[model samples]
Target: MIAEMAHLDVVVPPEIVDNETSGETTVEEGNSVTLTCKARGYPMPVVSWRREDNLKIVLRDQGNKKVTVTEGDQLRLTRVKRSDMGPYLCIAKNGIPPSVSKRIMLRVNFAPVLEVPVHMIGSPLGKEVTVRCKVESSPRAVATWRKEPGEQMIISSHKYNVTEYKEGFYVTQMSLTIRNFTLEDAITYRCVASNSLGATASSVQVYEIQPQKTRTSTKNDGDDSRLGNQIPLAASDHDKNDLDDFYNELDDPINNYLDPYHPGGILDNDRDREPLLKDPDIPKSPTGSKTFPYLNGGGGEGAVGIGSRWWWWAWVVVVVFWSVVLPGRVAF
Candidate 1:
């Protein structure tokens, strides 16, 4: 039992750590990340770190680029970017067989960015034209089109359409379609892509191609000769006065024929019914004073005229009858 125990103790390795450092990590840009590599061994093994894919680990803070760390059990990264994401290897071996390693995945999330080229083209009327742009982002972005110098979004309709295509996991193509194109479709159109992080934009110009017109010209000297041979016209004072009178008649005529609601129109078409232009009902000669007589106290009766020398006896009888019948009214 002593010989077996000695052999077992002699065969034990100095570094015999298990693979307990494997994990997954996710971090945003401009933030810090810490990766822990812990292990246990017979002689307390030392830790060394390296990239699994044989790539450079860039330290943007200290200007240390393409570096390899051969020490430290903890791997720290500050201001992590999207390009720093990959599998990391942590190996533990102190002259032992079957070496141990762990892969820690680090994910970096960022905002969307656009890299678009300017394109200008002329399209004919009643045709379809496409305005296309490209984008790159970690998370998928929502795309839209807006008319510039204005921020109002382009409302999709039968003549306008918006679409997107994914070229890769991080690259995409955003486009807009103008169907049955017209002159109004020519504008400075901008394509926008947005996500939780930020937004980016690009612009394209579309123009309407006007059709060329053909012209036919005729050259003839006879036309000028004919115009010269024609009599020269002259306006006399009488013609000018007639023209002025006609214009005045048109502006303020004696009657309005075209007006439907003219009060002067005789709808009955009878001269006796023209209320404004017809003769008045009053007589030319005045009536006798008998129509409304005045009292003559000298004769004790009402007379047709005060100039009359004689007062009729019938007038006295009428005054007595009226006074007796209507005592409440004054007889006149």
Candidate 2:
């Protein structure tokens, strides 16, 4: 039994550590943290530390800490940020058996971020109005105005000529003057405020001008009048008589002249009646036919009716004269 134990001891490793140190770390910006690895082994194991991302290893020691490996074993980080939280590795090896320690994570906490102030400017209508926006955070914020659309914002330049003032945590102001307020001048004015964490935008304020009214005229029977006035009219004697004649003439032989080519035969005729010059509901005839056939055929025979009728009378006069003169001459 003794000989078997001696052979097994020769095969066993010297740096076999059974215990490890447990360290708790909480870090922040401009702060430091230390993680210690106290291990037990037969040959006094050597502790080595490294970062997972291949960063240069650093070590630091405090009071009651001796035989310090301040260059490779103990980790000391200064001015840590929230991003420094990760796994740190520590290994124990005595040139015999290698032992590893569980990873340690250092978390860095910080306060809430303070954002920039928001700037809002009202439009330049002669009408008076208020412009306002708000900012809230521990650290005070600086705000600016810009006109960029769907792009990185820039400060409002001097050319725009805006008046600016600060009110507590918020910044705002109205335009010095609106040169011209017109319908075409309406536009989306943007207000933006930013901080270290992020930026936000306010709803656009729009400017609109009420349309102006102008004088318009409406027609009445004898003269024009505004629609507001309801003039109870009394018809004149001549007007009543003219209207009565107009309606009576509508169905009379004067105006119901049916179109000749319009499939309807002639139904009425009156010499005293000629078609009214302006008929409102009448559809004009494309074929230039006249209402009276006698009028269209050129006064019967092209300007010869009167000459023919008078020609017979002229012959009678001439015969009577000649007969009288010839008989007297023979008697003499």
Candidate 3:
């Protein structure tokens, strides 16, 4: 009897934490859930909860107040999302060398939803345009492109090109490219994103490009320096009279020397050389108004001098003509 009792004295190691992952606990979005976790051991282990993937656990209280619980049991989520489909950890510890934990996966199913950034899109003629439709669903959605009032599916063709591109984890983009868009391509196009759950659509208004008005730039007459292509306008009667007067005055060489101060008389210095009783301005020059250099001593610069400042006027005209004609002539 003593030998048989010795076998009953064998000590049993502590039991690791055990979590229940039973029958399908699939829950739809916008539903409540209460997952329970319990563990039995020699030391009466303590139970806790966490995300197995190290993500944050979102929970709600009685009043539907959102609370982020990092360390706790019974992860009660008021409204669940498809992201809550991942695994969660239920931990138990009782002075055990290695703590025990269990993983419970929550599955949530949702329908497809689609949205386009803009309702209206425009493209010019002879240009290619792309329309993007964003889709979101638990199961990957199959996007179909077509025009309004026609539920038929679109296939890859010469003019139209349909392609699917995933933008983010849950967001996918459906693009329809139309090459050389014209008035026929400018219509209300529809995109339908469908999954096992349901289907959704987004309408895009493609507007026909209107003819741009040809702008005729107005020429500003005041801008003279940059007006290389400026056309001359018809002169008025007053302009004609002024032009005729200018030509008539230029015809008389004597009028070129008219001075404001000495209107009808020779210059004072000129009068000193040869005094005249009559005015020089009155169409008829006084007798002996002409001063011939040969009559006087004509050799040097002073030899060719006139009675008044007429010599300087002639010198200025010669200098102007030489400077304009021989601009490249180097002077030593």
Clashes of each: 0, 4, 0
Q: Please, what are the lDDT tens digits per residue for candidate 3 over residues 88-176?
A: 77777777547777777776768888889888989898898888888887667888888876766777799889988886445788888
Query: lDDT tens string, model 1, 282-317?
Result: 112233222111222222222222323336556766
Global fold similarity of model 2 (TM-score): 0.28
lDDT (C-alpha) at residue 170 in model 1: 61
Structural similarity to truth (TM-score) of each candidate? 0.45, 0.28, 0.52
Colliding residue pairs in candidate 1:
none
TM-score of 1: 0.45
Best-fitting candidate, measured by TM-score?
3
Overall local distance difference test of candidate 2 = 0.46
Q: List the residue pairs that clash in candidate 3.
A: none
Error of 2 at 194 (Å): 16
Model 2 lowest lDDT segment of ten: 297-306
Candidate 3's C-alpha runs over 4 A off are 1-19, 22-25, 36-47, 51-56, 70-73, 81-87, 91-104, 166-170, 211-216, 221-332
**Per-residue lDDT of candidate 2, residues 37-153 (tens digit):** 664455666676665655543322243232322334456665554445556666676656546555665545443332323233345454443333444321234444444354444
